[model samples]
Target: MSTFKAPKGTYDLIPPVSETFLAVREALAAPLRRAGYGYVETPGFESVELFARGVGESTDIVTKEMYAFTTKGGDELALRPEGTASVLRAALEANLHKAGNLPVKLWYSGSYYRYERPQKGRYRHFSQVGAEAIGAEDPALDAELIILAVDAYKSLGLRTFRLLLNSLGDKECRPVYRAALQDFLRGLDLDDDTRRRIDINPLRVLDDKREAVQKQLTGAPMMRDHLCEACKTYHEQVRELLTAAGVEFEDDPKLVRGLDYYTRTTFEFVHDGLGSQSAVGGGGRYDGLSEMIGGPELPSVGWALGVDRTVLALEAEGVELHVPASTQVFTVALGEEARRTLFGVVTELRRAGVPTDFAFGGKGLKNAMKSANRSGARYAIVAGERDLAEGGVQLKDLQSGEQAPVALGEIVAELRRKLV
Candidate 1:
C-alpha cells in the first residue's frame, strides 16, 4: 500500500472530474471577463495583519479559521482564508484606484485555506473564482455583479440557488444602529463571548448560527429599520435596478455577512439542496475595507463562489456538466513502421489543436484496439504496413464503427474537418 496520503480535509482532482471542475471555473469567469474584469493573481499567503484588519477581528474567519504563523524572521503571516482582502491589498499596493478608472474591475481564481472542521460541503483547502469592482459605489455596479453571478450559475445549468440581499447601512446610520444594537444586546441573557462581540462588532451577532445566540437575536434591531436616508435611497436603487434587469432576490434584514467590511449592500447565494452548508457563494459592498487596511478610501464589491461546494450543489440537483472527451483521436499502429508513421500523425494532429493519443508499444492489435476504446476517443487512426505502402491510413469512427481510408498526406486535414 502507498504510505503517503492526501492531507486531511483535502482531495485530488483527476481525469474526467477535473475536466468538469475546469469547465465550471471557466464558465464562472467568462461573464466577468466579457464585462471588463481583468484577471489578478496574488500570493497564497500575506501578512497576518492584512486579513486581521481587512476582514473583521470579530469574524469567525479571523478569530477561528485563519491559518496564521510566525516565520523565522519573526514576521507574522497567514494563508489567505478569503480572496477579497488579498485582491484589495494588491490593488492598493499597485495604486489601481489612481489609474483614473472609476472602477478598477478584476477577477481571480485560486485556492483559499482555513482551519475549520471539514464537512461534506466545506473543506480546509477549497477553490474559489471571485471578482471585484473597486473605486465606484453605484447601484448599477451592484446589480451587474449580482446579474453576472446569476448568469454564471445559469450557464452551469444550476436551477435551485437563491440570492439573499440586504443593506448594512453605511457610516451615516450604522453608528446609530450599532449603539442601539449594543444597548439591546447588553440587556440580553448571554455569555461573555457574545457580550464581548457587542463591544467589538455588533453586526456579527446576527450571523451567529448557534441556536441560543440566534434565539437571543430574535428581537435584535434589524438593519433595514436603521437605514439612513442616503442608504435607503441607495438600497432602493439597487432593488429597482435588479427588478428592471429581471433578477430576483429576497430581502433579508438579518443577513449580516461573515465580514465587518460589508456596508450599504450585502448578499449571499444559497442553495436549498445543500442542507446546513447552504451558501454556495456570497459577498457585499466593502466600502470601508480600503480605509480599514490603511489604504485610501475605495469602495468595492465582489463575490467568491466555492468551486467544490458548487460541484456538490450540482450533484445535489443531479446535473452533470457536458465535458467533452479528453482524447479526441486515438492512434493504434499495427507494426514498427506503422508505429513511426502513426506517432508522427499523432504529433501532427495534436499540434493542430486536436486532443490526440497514440499507442506507444508494439502491442497486439486486439490489446491496442481495447486501449483506444478506453481512451474515450471519438475516432481512431489505424495504419498497417500494407496501408502505408498504399499511401493511405484507415480512419475509424469509434462512435459509429465506420471505417474509411484517407490518403496519408490528407489524413490530418481530413481528421481536422471531421473533428471540428
Candidate 2:
C-alpha cells in the first residue's frame, strides 16, 4: 500500500461529511445576505506585514502561528491565519469605504493557515465563515454583529453555545488600565514570558488560562473600572441594545482577545459541549486596525465562526442537519436501446431544472435498481426496451417501492409533482 496520509493538524472534508460544512456556509450566508451584507473574497496570502502590523507582533498568531515566507520574487508573504486583517486590507485597497457606503458590510468564507501544535478543534489549516463591518463605529453596530452571529448559530439549530462579551476599552482609556494592570501583575510571581507580555500587552495577562495565574490575578484591575466616560457609556449602550434585542451574554471582565487591533467591544462564542477547544468563534471592534495596517483610518467590527468546531458543536448536541441527499432523479437504463433513448430524456430533464444522474456501462435491472437505491434519490426513472418502445418510462418511488408507467413527455412533470 502507498504510505500517504493527510498532513498532521489538517483534515479533508470529504464525501457525505462535507455536506455538513456546506450546510454551515449556507446557513451563515443566508443571514448575512438578509441583513444586507455583501459577499467578499480576498487572496489566500498577503504581505507578511499585513498580519505583523494588523494582528499584533506580540500576539501568538503573528509571533508563532503565522505561515510566513519569502517568495521567489523576494516578496515577504504569509498565508492568512485569520480573516479580519485581510478582509479589512482588501476594503482599504479597493477604496470600498469611500464609495459612499458607511460601514461597508461584507461576509467571507475561506480556509486559513497557521502553524501550531495540533489539538482538538485546533489545526494548521481551518475553514471559517467571517463577516466584517467597516467604516462605522456605533454601539448598535457592535450589538448587531453579535446578534448576527447568534442568529446564525440558532438558525443552524445549535443550542449549546454561549456569548461572552466584554469591552477592552478604546485607545483613549486602555493605556490607563494597562498601567494599573501592569502594576498589579508585577507584584505577582510570573515567568519571563508573562512578564514580557505585561510590558507589550498587560491586558493579555488576564487571558492566562493557568490555574496559578488565575489565582494570583483575581484582585488585579479590571478594564471595566478604568474605561473612559465615553467608552463606559458606549459599553452600557451596547449591553442595553443586546438585551433589548433578546441577545443574552455574560459579562467577562477577563476577555482580552488574542489580537491587538480589537478595541472596546469584544466577544467570544463558546460551546459547552466541545471541551478544551470550546470557542466556536469570536471577534470584536477594531477602530485602529486600518491605521495599524497603513491604510486610511477606518473603524471596523467583525467575527469569524469556525466551521470545523461548529460541526462538532452540532454533533455534541445530537443535532443532525438534514442535508439534501439527492439533487434530482436518477435514471436507470435497463437495455442498450433504453440507455440511448433515456439519454435524451435525461438531458431534457436537466434543461428543465431537474438535476438528474444516470448509470453508465451495462448493468442488469436488479443491479441498476441497487445503484438507484444507493443514490439516495427519492424516485428512480426505470426504462427498458419494452417501456421505451411504448413511448413511456417506469417511475419507481425508491422510498415506497411503488411504480407507475408515465408517458415520456410527462416525466419532468411527474417527477416534479412527486418531489414537491
RMSD of candidates 1 onward, in order: 1.2, 1.2
Model 1 misplaced stretches (Cα beyond 4 Å): none
Residue pairs clashing in model 1 are none
166: Cα error in model 2, Å: 0.4
The candidate that wins on lDDT is: 1
What is the C-alpha RMSD, rounded to one decimal, of candidate 2? Answer: 1.2
* 1-420: candidate 2 lDDT, tens digit per residue: 859988999999897899889998889778888899999999999999999999998998988899999999999999999999999988888899989869999999999999989998899999999999999989988898899889999999998799999999988998888889888999999999999998998887888889989999878889999999999999999999999999889999999878888999999999999888899999999999999988888888999999999998999999999898754688989878889988888898889878788886688888877888888888889998999889999998888899999999898888877777
- Model-by-model lDDT, in order? 0.92, 0.90
TM-score of 1: 0.98
Candidate 2 local accuracy as lDDT?
Answer: 0.90
Estimate the TM-score of every prediction: 0.98, 0.98
